[model samples]
Target: MDFGCDPGEWTDAWSATGISHHWALGTGHCIAELKALADLMDVEFVEVDPA
Candidate 1:
C-alpha cells in the first residue's frame, strides 16, 4: 500500500490495455490478502458502515 508514485510516471504505464489488465490483477491480489487476514480473525470484511 505504500506506493511511491513519481509525477507522470504511471500515466503512460497504465495507458495500454495489457498494462491495465496487469494492474487489475495486482489489485486483486491485494484484496485477496485482506480477505485472508479477515478470515484468520473470523471477521467479516466490510467496506461500509455496519449500521
Candidate 2:
C-alpha cells in the first residue's frame, strides 16, 4: 500500500479496473465495487486504509 506515484497510471489503471493487491492475491479485497466479483469468486473483501 506504500506505492509511489512515479507511474501514476499504475494506480489509475488499478482503480479503473477495480483491482487491489488484496484482490489480486486472493487474500482480501478493498475496493467496494469489486466486492461483487470477489463474492462470485468466493473471495473475502477486507477493508483497508488508503495509501
Candidate 3:
C-alpha cells in the first residue's frame, strides 16, 4: 500500500467494473481520507522515499 497520489474514483456497486492499468487514469479520491481509512483497516500505507 503506497501512500502516494494514485488517480482513481469509486464506481457503481450495481455495475461491475473492470480493472485497467492505463497511464491516463483519472483521480477523484482524497488521499488523506484514504490514509485514515486504511489505518483503521490495519493496512500499512508506505510512501516511497525520493531520496
Candidate 4:
C-alpha cells in the first residue's frame, strides 16, 4: 500500500514462531492513513500496548 510521497518506511517482520504479524507504522501521515483505512473498513481503531 502506497500513501503517496513520504519519507517513512515500514516492514513486515515475522516472529520466530511464525504465528503473528507485527506492523510498525511511522508517525504523522501514517496515523492519517491508518485512520482512513479503519474508516474504510468500517471498524474501530484501538491501540493497545503489549507491555
Worst 10 residues of 1 by lDDT: 20-29
User: Is 2 or 3 the stronger prediction by lDDT?
Assistant: 2
Model 1 alpha-carbon drift over 4 Å, by segment: 1-29, 47-51
Task: Give residue 45's error in model 1 in angstroms.
Answer: 0.6
Taken over the whole model, the C-alpha lDDT of each candidate is: 0.53, 0.59, 0.46, 0.54
Ranking by lDDT: 2, 4, 1, 3
Alpha carbon deviation, residue 11, candidate 4 (Å): 18
Model 3 TM-score on a 0 to 1 scale: 0.32
Candidate 2 Cα deviation (angstroms), residue 28: 15
lDDT of 2: 0.59
Q: Per-residue lDDT of 7-30 in model 3, one digit per residue for the tens?
A: 232333212455444212223355
Q: What is the TM-score of each candidate against the true structure?
A: 0.33, 0.33, 0.32, 0.35
Return the TM-score for candidate 1, rounded to 2 decimals. Answer: 0.33
Score candidate 4 by lDDT: 0.54
- Runs in model 4 lying further than 4 Å from the true structure: 1-29, 47-51
Best by lDDT: 2
